[model samples]
Target: MPRRLTRTLRRWLYIGHRWIGIITCLFFAMWFVSGVVMMYVAFPGLSEKERLAALPDMAWEKVRLSPDAAMAAAGAKTFPRDLRLQMLDDEPVYRLTGWDGQRQTISASDGHGIDGVTLDRALAVARHYPGAADVQSIEMVERDQWSVTARYDPFRPLYQIALNDAAGTRLYVSSRTGEIVLDTSATERVWNWLGSIPHWIYPTVLRKDNALWRQVILWLSGICLVVAVSGIWIGILRVRLRRRYSGGRVTPYRGWMAWHHVTGLFAGVFVLTWMFSGWLSVNPGEVFSSRGPSREMLQRYAGHDAPTVAAVVAVTPSSRAVEARFVWLGGAPLMLLANRQGRKLPSIP
Candidate 1:
């Protein structure tokens, strides 16, 4: 190539490197810091153990309706996505979850449907927790700073109950089915201030709208990916390995520029992987499949043979269970008995 043309190309590459680095440096810094916090604290979510622990001991005597009866009450014409038999306010209840954000809770005694988390009902739920002897405050919310993610969208109009506990714990209950969707204590909130909240640029007003939150993250990550790639190229060129100074010194400049170059050398790969993976996380394309069975697969599994109310009215479980949930497999209702240890194999009908 001509010297003049080569000089012009180099100048443009330098411009690209300088501007892109300035544009993406802060986000890269945030990602590095927040990733460490995420490794330790994680985002606030309800673990299965915690959710089960929050409930009162199972009153087996309260379970009059069978698993099949619970499924029937939810109007499961073919097969439901998921079903759980739980105790709500000392009453045996069945929570039926289906695709496309469908949720229903039915009485396990007589199959009466229960809906919505009224303020009074929310207080009743708070009492189920051991530390929550008395409810201090109840906030009727659609979405907030804590519950800003799209995963919380299905459980709209959540009831955030502050339990009077040592940890200053808060429980978020779904108004749709009156189920405890998330639990957060003082420690989680303190750690997450440096974790998920800033890492994902998550805020109530922006994240409550699912479409916007996704777009923001997707586009931001895409831009950052470009910056990281360009930075790698510029670093490779600037790094000298032939001269005396080149053996030890990779960056020619000192101060912030050196900081940028040296840190970029060490951290550039992480920045690239994180940006690319973060974009991939949203899965702008159908690169990966979701864990749940597809609607068609579920329909096929329950094909021709529609589920009927099981004849077994009484259950004589061998082991003690904190709670029992039901699931449909091969068009038959299967009971999942769970205890403090974990869930046992689904009891065959």
Candidate 2:
């Protein structure tokens, strides 16, 4: 390259580096601080432990209807992807999930359809919560800052119930499933404001639409990735082992420029990795392996056979359980019980 052209290129590179560095460095600092908060208290979701704890144990005595009858009521031609017995306002009910992701709840007493949660039913659900206080207020949640992720899409129009607790506990009960989908205590809510919400740009208006939120985060991280890489390169280019024109110096720049250069030199790898990992979180190109279950795995677990209503009715309760699942153990049928406290156990029968 000619000397004049090289000079012009260097000048523009410096300008781009300065402005982009200012913005990207701000993000880098926020990411570092917020990442530590997330390390302990993650954004709230319905974890398995939490779900089990909230469940009302299986009322084996109340199960009068059969699984076959429940399937018939659902009009399912194939074996359901998932089928389990749960208590819906004290009565035994079957929550059947289909391979196509359709969910149907049928009365275990008489095999009638349960459309969704009513206001009274919502209140009842709240009253049954484990650490619940008197229900303060209940509102139908279409979408909100906390429940905007795609995972919550299936539970749209969830019932948000506020509890009169010191932690400002809130429960998101699915209207269709009538199950608690997300639980946020006051501590979790407060910490996430500094943690996940800002780091992921997770405001309701932007996050409600899953695709849009993903793109926004991916591109912003990509920009920061660029800035960090370029900064590392420039820091290297300007580094001097022996003094060029000053008292023994490794960095050519002076003052804030020198501090930015020195600090970035040591922390550049961290900054770069953080931005890259955040970009990977969106799985920009499917570089990482898939998360959770696959369709084939789900089908395999479901198998071809299903439990009959006779067996369901035959189960004698060992203890009060919130839900029960029929499973085959060593060729014999058994009922898996989820106690009110979330313990999983085999039925006495």
Candidate 3:
């Protein structure tokens, strides 16, 4: 009975390995090739340098309202987490951000709140990009393959403008604030089809729903992991390291079968480790969930239970500044200014 049970179990192992290996072989090839492509090109995004370079200098002379008035018009009840004054197209606007991630844009010229950006405004914003050529066409995109990530949620309903420049650059302008949220070149879009898109299993339909995407990755990697383990086990059972085969060979198989058996023995550990690591990437069962700082830990880091910033009445900003930032540091309120070059101007207390 014992010998019969052993033979039955071995047969099942072989069957499991062969079938699962056939199923996951495509995924393995895709991941290996796409991972290499990813090393050269990353997903599309707007860098700080690109954004700053595209912005027109702040026209302080056009400002008829003060920072205090702008904040009040934005309905800010307390000192906001972030406040910045920058140009929106040709007019100056103040962007106020709350601690809970809420944002409001207020016009500095008339102290009125900005409701939404028009198509003409979006086109005007796009023209400011360096080396921008004649406009090819503009399409309204709620969410597409390049802008499917959650980070672009705040800037939904984007205006995708294609420029006729040599680079075939496409710029995404937020319909809410008229800010250029992201830009992608022709080269970036083409390479990413084989790079981050496939490597991350990112498709517009799949990635739009974050929860469903995570589940898909988890299940696919889990099944592939089972294949890796079974392959290693079957390889060990078939390989003969000490005892020679019929022709004094370590593996009884010939041609491709021999190559596979011999290499599987030597490379099994690496393949298993690689497959296991990929499974862990999605943090299955919340095994790798972040243990971020608690309330107590945050207080300890800040050296205080709570730190507050007092709203201060300010004069008109100098003409040299392109942007102004309100921040509280070391329990003191400060106003930092930045020029068009992105250099920090003197801070005012």
lDDT of each: 0.76, 0.78, 0.80
Worst 10 residues of 3 by lDDT: 304-313
Best by lDDT: 3
Residue-by-residue lDDT tens digits, candidate 1, 1-349: 6999988997898898688778787887887898889899977889888887777667778888875787777777754666677678678787777665688888988888987657777778777775775685567888777887778877888888898788989999888777788888899999898998889888778877778888888888888888788888888878777762543775687779888877888789987886787799887855688977878877677552354536353354555666776555665656767765566656765
| Candidate 2 wrong stretches, greater than 4 Å | 287-289, 301-310, 327-334, 346-349
Candidate 2, residues 1-349, lDDT tens digits: the string is: 5999988987887789899878777887787788888999899887887777776666777788877788888897866767788887787898887777788889998888988877677777777777688886567889887888777777778889997877788998888878778988889889999999987788889887778888888888888888888889888878887655477778878898789888998788887886787688799866778987986665466454443433544454566667777654444555677776767787633
**Clash totals, every prediction:** 0, 8, 0
RMSD of 2: 2.6
**What's the residue-level lDDT of 254 in candidate 2?**
88
* Model 3 lDDT, full chain set: 0.80
1 or 3: which has the higher TM-score?
3
Write down the worst ten-residue block by lDDT for model 2. 304-313
| Clashing residue pairs found in predicted model 2 | 56-321, 56-322, 57-321, 57-322, 58-321, 58-322, 66-309, 167-186
Which prediction has more favorable lDDT, 2 or 3?
3
Encode model 3's per-residue lDDT on 84-188: one tens digit a residue. 878998998988877667778999899888868998889999998888998644789999999999988877899999877899999999998899999999999
**TM-score versus the correct structure, for each prediction:** 0.85, 0.90, 0.87
